[model samples]
Target chain A: MNTDPTRLSAAELAHAIASKELSSVEVVQAHLDRIAAVDADVHAFLHVDGAGALDAARAVDERRASGEDLHVLAGVPIAVKDVMATKGLPTTCGSKILEGWIPPYDATLVSRLKAAGMPILGKTNMDEFAMGSSTEHSAYGPTHNPWDLTRIPGGSGGGSSAVVAAYEAPLAIGTDTGGSIRQPASVTGTVGVKPTYGGVSRYGLVALASSLDQAGPCTRTVLDAALLHSVIGGHDPMDSTSINAPVPSVVEAARRADVKGLKVGVIKELGGEGYQAGVRARFDESVTLLQEAGAEVVEVSCPSFDYALAAYYLILPSEASSNLAKFDAMRYGLRVLPEGIEDPSAEQVMAATRDAGFGDEVKRRIILGTYALSSGYYDAYYGQAQKVRRLIANDFSTAFEQVDVLVSPTAPTTAFKLGDKLDDPMSMYLQDVATIPANLAGVPGMSLPSGLADEDGLPTGIQILAPATQDERLYNVGAALEKMLVDRWGGPLLAKAPQLTAKGA
Target chain B: MPPEHARGRFVVREAPRLAPMSALSRDDVAHLAGLARIDLSDAELDRMVGELGVILESVAKVQEVAADEIEPMSHPLPLTNVTRPDEVRPSLGAEAALAAAPEKEQQRFSVPRILDED
Candidate 1:
């Protein structure tokens, strides 16, 4: 057995367990120890299900002993972003309102993970209700970047990103609504994919923006992400928006890792201007590498992309305002009675609870959404944003006509300092400018670590987008680029992350 | 460890302004807050008026591209009228459903009274 079982990727760990060379219990224990050693500083997990994970690992070992057929990813452990519900496990979604709320039912994806015999380590932290670019919006506190502890792990899935980067878990789940998944992956030097809208089930996911939210794998390798994607992606009768078609051949594509004859379109509008010098340099080098690898690279202009950020904020807030209306202090979650008032009305309690529970970013968006959806302003704001959404989708359809996949720098820059954009909401919103177009168009997008930016010595990620339902193309290009970058650096980008030792030990 | 302890560890960091503030009035913000059912103090409202004003001005660009011919799409997929047969299945039982309720009585969610006795 390897000295450190936690260091292996999910794919490798699965192979080891399948081969009988290593036990699932050992791997799970190693990860728990790693979490104990470092999570105090990283704070990736809101709750670590050490006992549950080990029990599941033992169950998998028994299944193997019985010679029963097991899933490919059986015995591998994963960290779930807290946004997804796990039956009997606390699913907080990084908000004080839902703190300590142990969901009675599992999200379809979580059930799938359990059925596949994947032990869930715990629920990871996230931006409060998945509302911010940096996890600082989390009511629990921010998840620091593993590369540089002073910096943020890109959010709202910062916890997932941090765990993968820090080697606490080999795989994780992250939902992207306006770049929650990809942006975090970019900044953390990991891999994250936002599967095609409706490509993955959203039944158990806590909704932020119904139209834009799609969960996918967060992993250290493109192949591992593809493997996890195969495990989780499928048609579900429970989710009306779920695609009835079969999950794309993402695993096969990742294994191929060949971009020969692929038309990779560099999005004309997604780069330059506000882009950091180091991010652009890394992105440019990756593009050149793709061209040299026999892929046909072209520049495709998606004009409506310019309005993507504007349309996304308006649409997201509008939907969020309506979706979040469920937390009314009635059925579930935190209920705060109005202070200094006897027999306060339910409405008064709800107002007070929300006022105390939700953080600034969540409040800001809710207000923006309420105003957008207001009766008088609906046509000019929410309605117009929906129209712009259509145009963005149209632009994607046209761009796909000339290209197999679109490429861009995942986020405008690498991970900024923890407090860099806290006061400025607009600057924080700009971080998702490159990744938002994919969610807007309902396309699949992947962010793979390109290289470390020269200026800040932080990781930069290259985003690959495929037309809706052709999600496999993202894996093909992503894997191809990941392999080339690994070869160039002589190791994975995450191998360069500064080790997190026990603080004050 | 109380949950609020986790919050208190990080100092509140404010963002630098990136967009020009527009004309969203304080009253407008208060009305939106009321509609959203989020009770905001006067200081928060004052800050929101400026923050939301800038956000609205930035997102107002959506109007520039809103053409009359372009139909608004509420979802990405074109399929509509998705329905399931109306058959009851086992679901969260009363105990499970009421378990997370902040206040419960008689297997029902208990809330503050709304009506005045006539």
Candidate 2:
């Protein structure tokens, strides 16, 4: 009961909850209070089910009282990004189109989390249908950066990043489509991982560029991600693309983290042009740290990384438009016809539904996707984009041949004000520069907290990328760097995070 | 930069510029929208036509460097045969499947008839 509530790490909280130093109900209540207090300004969550969360917490408490053996993450509070469906929870994907729709089933990842005994806090916000790089595209609203209330948190996982950064929750799950998780983590100074493409089951995740989407853990510490990721990742029969493989040994990799003798390739093209000086400085510093840790640092150029964004825009939007077609008002989603009309034409209802349901960014992509898929343009646009996708994958494979892993500043800059880049979607899309390649190549990528942006003093992140299916490499390198950085900084990156005590911490 | 990199996908070559279809006019955007079955107003079409051009221009960078000698990689990982074998398994039948349809009669979903579609 006396566990210091606000600042505890997920690992610490899990131990406390299991040892009875804290009650699951108390843990959920504290997070709920935090969300209630700080989230109004941060807008991290589109919907917070305080009552539902409390009920789940009480269930965990009862199980423990009955002397039931529990899972490792038992009673720990977790937030699900709105992009994933949770049974009975409003899984809106941060869109007004499906505002009050409750899902009938949980995503496979969510089911795994609940099975692990983690308490579901609520659904956090995300870009509308996970289409935007910034959460600004979310029809409900953009999530504010927790470090600075006025700045934008990265997206479409921005809401999840903000919730963990703001201490509204110690851990949350997020999906990454072209850097959604890592980019947000860069801006929020949290740990975000996008596992290998088929690492986690996508059965219940709202489809957003299915080929590019993969869900992973976002937390304040590397070990925390390892813990959560282990529980949710593995082969699933429900997803045809799910890898029929054992979960990578992330937890052990974290514990045995050592960068000595490893080769780290600094992608020559990632940092030089279009990146902020502050971000580059921190990236250079990270490379130096890696070298000092006995790892050989070298520059490996993945020129294909330069064209990745162009390839992604073509591929992702094309996929998004097709996927989102399921949300037609004729479906189980919103149906808004004329003010008063029975048996309105399905065409009119669908037109009205998409117009109201989708935001400008989403609509823009859908149109572009439609154009690309059009018979007249498909061979040139979609065909070329798919070819370029192959080129990018080749570039990653070639680069890994020279280096054990690649590193870069997770994003070009730190957190920006919410509205800063919204006006120009191109600039917003460019923000995923460091993150897109891994997703494009179907490999693994993770962002570890680095130093703060000199200008805004908000946290920045450094990314570590690995070859496909070698997700354990990311944890091995990431955990080593995180532990070293924490030791140098005298604690975890969030140690200096502004403490916002709930009504009664 | 390395040549013929491992797990190679698209190849990038320097082009004086990435070229997109200049064929798209304002009317083209409107026509494309209709074909896609999404409704867009004139004002929306006006903006979309221009935005689509730039997006096309930006993404056309892919076309600049890829050589005809290179084969495109559709997926990053070299994975194949991601299918489950057919087996007798329980499934939610037609009643449960169409349970949420807005209009239903005699175990069938009723909707305003449209041309063949999903």
Candidate 3:
């Protein structure tokens, strides 16, 4: 058995616990210790529930001792993005507005994680309301890339990806609305998936863009993602939009890991021009490797994808504006009285609270959404964006007809320095160009490390997109590509990252 | 090739070739912020005017191919009117529900004055 339980994959740790080789308490404690040692520099977690995790781990050990049948992932520890509601845990959604607001009920996915007996480590950091491409928007703080401490891990789900890459947790849950999950995974050299839009229940996921938001897995390996996915996915009575179908056989597909005779499409629109040269090189090499493995590779065009970013900006702001309207200093969350007012009216108080609570980016989107949905501009902006959404979806349908799956570089570049694009919102928005189309179309997407970029020696990721409801295909191809890449590098890409010890040690 | 619906259609609003980049003004942003119930500081309003202009200019590209014949898609799924059998079930107790509220009184959410004193 591995001496350091922190280094073991969630699958291996689960196996060891099930076989009574390593107790669940030891596994959970090793992760808690890892979080203690390295999380200072990584800033991957907003809170670490050490006591709660130990209690859960102890219960699992007792259950195993009593010869109780347990779920496959039972006893394995997991981290969750702060965006999802956790019954008794703070779910701030990286915003000051909801700071210290503990949910009354667990999100459907959180309930599933608890039911599977996975010990919850705590809430990870994120962009405020999952709005930005960089986690710098987080009111708490940005999560730094484990590879290069000065660089971004990726936004919205940066903390989840960082935790997995830094070995703070073997598995984490991340929600993707316009590439939150996959983009972070790309920059961090970890695996992240955005399942089909309705594939996972969104009952207690604080709504960002109701149409685009979907929670999926963040993990060190493809199989671990599949394992976590099956546990959290499936229909829920609480989420009316959740797909009423069994989760695809992702575990079986992951183990199959054979891409022979598979038709792979390299998206014509997603590469060249804006893409970093090193990113393109890694993607091309990955495609060649796939061809060498007997998979047929072809270039397919989804021209309508050219407008996907534009449509997303409009649609997301429109929905987010409405979704965020609930934080009006009324029912819950932070409340502030208007300055210089003896008796502030409800409207005045709401405005004051919002101004004090929301960060610049959140306010920007809310204002944009408000304008988009306003009287005369509604048809010109929101309605037109909706039409474009259909066009993008149609493009996916057309492309999927020619190929089994579409592929691209997950993000346009490797991790940039923390403050590089902070001032320029448009430049930051361009980072999600390749990953957003999958979310807009509601198809599943997976991002796995392709290779390190030659120029910067930073990790680059290859993204795989499958048709809606055919999520298993992503795992199948992702696992196959990951295996090939690992064999070439002689280990996982994360092995190349700079090692971190306890801060000030 | 354009999709069937988008091809050869006379649209009510012809897609603008190049929407003016500086179309949004500081006053417009302030108005929008007011509508959203956010009291933006003058500094924030100034910065947002520039930032949001760029974003709006870029996102305006969505109007390019939004032909009249194309249908608007609100959601990825085709689900509509999803319902379950009506039955009383366990729910959050009043205390639990009001636990996180900023102000609560008499088992209900308390708020600032909504009407002027008569």
Query: Which candidate achieves the best DockQ against the true structure?
Result: 3
Label model 2 with its docking quality class. Answer: acceptable
TM-score of each model, in listed order: 0.96, 0.93, 0.97
Cα lDDT computed for each candidate against the true fold: 0.90, 0.83, 0.92
lDDT of 1 by residue, B29-71 (tens): 8988988999999999989888887788889877655256789
lDDT (C-alpha) at residue A317 in model 2: 81
Candidate 2 stretches with Cα past 4 Å from truth are A338-344, A499-505, B1-23, B82-110, B113-118
Q: Candidate 3, A60: how far from true, in Å?
A: 0.6
TM-score of chain A of 1: 0.99
Instruction: List the RMSD of every prediction in angstroms.
Output: 7.6, 3.6, 2.4
**Model 3 alpha-carbon drift over 4 Å, by segment:** B1-21
Q: Write the number of the candidate with greater DockQ, choosing between 1 and 3.
A: 3
Question: Model 2 chain A — which ten-residue stretch has the worst lDDT?
Answer: A496-505
| Model 3: per-residue Cα lDDT at residue A429 | 91
TM-score-wise, the better of 1 and 3 is: 3
Q: Candidate 3: deviation at residue A173, Å? A: 0.5
In candidate 2 the C-alpha lDDT for residue A497 amounts to 66
Ten contiguous residues minimizing lDDT sum, candidate 1 chain A: A496-505
